[model samples]
Target: MTTWRDVQAAAPEFARRVQSLFDAHKHKTIATLRADGSPRISGIETAFTDGELTFGSMPNARKGSDLHRDPRFALHTATVDPVEGNEAEWPGEAKIAGRAVHSGSIPDGPDGDLFRADITEVVLTHLDDSATLLVIEWWTPTNGLRAVERE
Candidate 1:
């Protein structure tokens, strides 16, 4: 697994783009595994600080509980609707998949649970200028960055 800092160091431009997508919105979605191995999606806010990607959950929240039992997760940046009849205007979407390492508890009043991401994969998808081509970029600890375009 790689930290956010590792990605930045290996692929600065790709990391920047991914970070921009995450920064463009406030709320992101995190997918966790349920006990039965099903998927559970939850709204979450993440912080990229001190070279780590982290998030917190309210005490005993289902999402928190899910992570406690299964640390694997896929986090997606918030989606923005494409402009009417102008799909090219869409800013695109980003996703990070990894395992969460329990980092401890939030220092403040509410006693939230904190987890740091151990990113294994990151992806960004967007469209070409005419919206005729789909562009997909992906990065991993070993692979760094690679892109693909399709109609």
Candidate 2:
């Protein structure tokens, strides 16, 4: 499984941008599939440590149960609304999609469930320097980093 460190080694610039977004805030969003295959979004905090992205859930939390049943997940960085006239300064957003592999248990923390991410895709979206185009950079295990710009 590819770790966040692997991504950093492979695509440092892209990884830096993505990490900056995650570092800009503490609260992020994680999406998991429900029993009926519907989408469920949960507010979560993430940690980048020991070459892995980790998060936990309270005991018997629905999100924890969902991950136990299905590891697939997509995590998004927190975002701030752009100023009315200064939209160009917006820092942009980042997302990571992958599976959560059960790592172990959380110690002294409500006996919560812990999981580490196995990254499959990472993406960053932001305004270009001129702020006239939207720049999207994405990275995957096989394809590596790729970028696109749109008006």
Candidate 3:
């Protein structure tokens, strides 16, 4: 497991792009494993602060329970349909896959809880400037950063 700061330190430019995509939106989506091992998607918001990726959930939220039971999770930036004629201008989307570790309790009492992200992968997908190719970029603790482009 790697800290968010590790990604930043290993690939500052890549981290910047991913963070910008996340910061561009307030609401994101997270995928957690249900008890049956099925994938569960939930709406969430995360912050990159204090060299950590942090998120909170309501006291009785199912997503919170899922993370407690299985820390493995995936998070993606909120996305919008690209404009028909301005696809090239689309800023693209980002995703993060990792574990959520119980870091501390929420400040507003036991109404919720806070967790830190232990990242494994960070990905960015977008169209090239020419809008003729789709580019996929990813970073991992084991591989650093790499990318591929497709028509």
Candidate 4:
């Protein structure tokens, strides 16, 4: 099992990388399951606040609609590095899964809901190290995103 220490140890680098990827409005694709169990992908504005990630949607939109139908969704952020003279490119991606939750003030007053997700999985790809970490799979609403196992 990985501990908070693991995440903490990597936080500095991870945060820097994440910020670099998200600089000045970089859109990402948010994937979720349709009611029919098919995959749905859309580009959305991704934001991070105090280490927590969030995505917004219009009232009763499809992304929100999908969430209502099935809260399971995944967020992916990726980038491709093209090194001059190198015939190949190295791509990095991070994927996180969680249930969509409604939060913010929805104009409906206190009755409004904001969307959120309890990050269940965090995939970090470090090309220089040729390694990736798939972490905290066992996170539950009751226990939170503490690492469960490491392989």
Candidate 5:
């Protein structure tokens, strides 16, 4: 399992950009697997602190149950549509796919359950400076960062 710190060490600039996009919004989304192996998408918020990525769920929340039953998850940063004539000002959206590890028990706390990400991949997608081609970049624990531009 790779930590967010490991991703940072592997690709600092990419990590910084990814984190910025996450920080730009207060809410994001997460995809978890259901008992039937279908996907359940839910609204979520993330924290990048203490050199780790973390999120929480209300007690007995479906998402929490999903993680416990199946740790695999894909988290996405909230996105804002690019201004029609100001595409260059739109920061790319970011995504992270990995397993969710129980950070710890709340133990009489009101925050419900907390989990840390064991990242496998992080991706950023945006338009090029000329706002023509789309640029997609991804970083993995083993592969580092790679990019491709598409028209």
Candidate 6:
């Protein structure tokens, strides 16, 4: 179970970890729902703006189409071992629970598509080289990501 208080406390740390992996990891997997209740997944290079997340893709992609129909989305951002570096492979994952809605009229470049998700739940799990694995989970009132006051 996760509480708003915990989320408030951990959000800064979470943001830092995420930023570390953003360009280095370069790949994020997003899972969305199909109309028939099946799962659709895709790899995306995510962009975060004003606390909202967005990505670029073809209009026909399953994720884009699914968002049109279902609007719900889940994002998993993970890190892999670097080829050679002083940086340790701190495997971390964040679960983003939010609704996907079309943001722009024109589909071009980074401005192509926009998804404003009211991330309500963020569960960050990481394997620490110096310490044991750590897991932090946070939840919102609606149970999943929706509109909620930021900490």
Q: Evaluate candidate 1 by giving its C-alpha RMSD to the native, one decimal.
A: 1.3
Report the candidate with higher lDDT, 3 versus 4. 3
Give TM-scores for every candidate, taking all chains together and pairing residue i with residue i.
Answer: 0.94, 0.96, 0.95, 0.63, 0.95, 0.68
Tens-place lDDT per residue, model 4, 81-146, is: 546554233334556667776666443333334565566555554344322332333233344444
lDDT of 1 by residue, 48-143 (tens): 897788888899898999999999999999988788899998889999999999988976657899899999999999999899899999999987
For residues 65-139, what per-residue lDDT tens digits would candidate 2 score against the true structure? 999999999999997887777879989999999999997897546688889999999999999887889999999
Runs in model 4 lying further than 4 Å from the true structure:
1-12, 84-91, 106-113, 129-151
Q: TM-score of predicted model 5?
A: 0.95
- Cα lDDT tens digits, model 6, 1-151, are 3332334445566555544555456788888898898998888777764555666556677788788888877778754653345334655566666676677643456434566665556655554454343445444544532222222
- What are the runs in model 1 whose C-alpha is more than 4 Å off? none
The reply for model 6, stretches above 4 Å from the true place, is 1-10, 79-91, 106-112, 139-151
Q: Which of the two candidates, 1 or 5, achieves a greater TM-score against the reference? A: 5
Off by over 4 Å in 2: none
CA-lDDT, candidates in order: 0.91, 0.91, 0.92, 0.57, 0.92, 0.60
For 1-151, candidate 5 gives per-residue lDDT tens digits of: 7988998888898899999999998999999999999999999988888789988888899999999999999999997899999998789899999999987765444768999999999999999999998899999888889999999
Q: Residue 81, candidate 2: how far off, in angstroms?
A: 1.6
Clashing pairs in 4: 101-115, 101-116, 102-114, 103-113, 103-114, 103-115, 104-114
How far residue 30's Cα lies from its native spot in candidate 3, in Å, is 0.5
- In candidate 5 the C-alpha lDDT for residue 142 amounts to 81
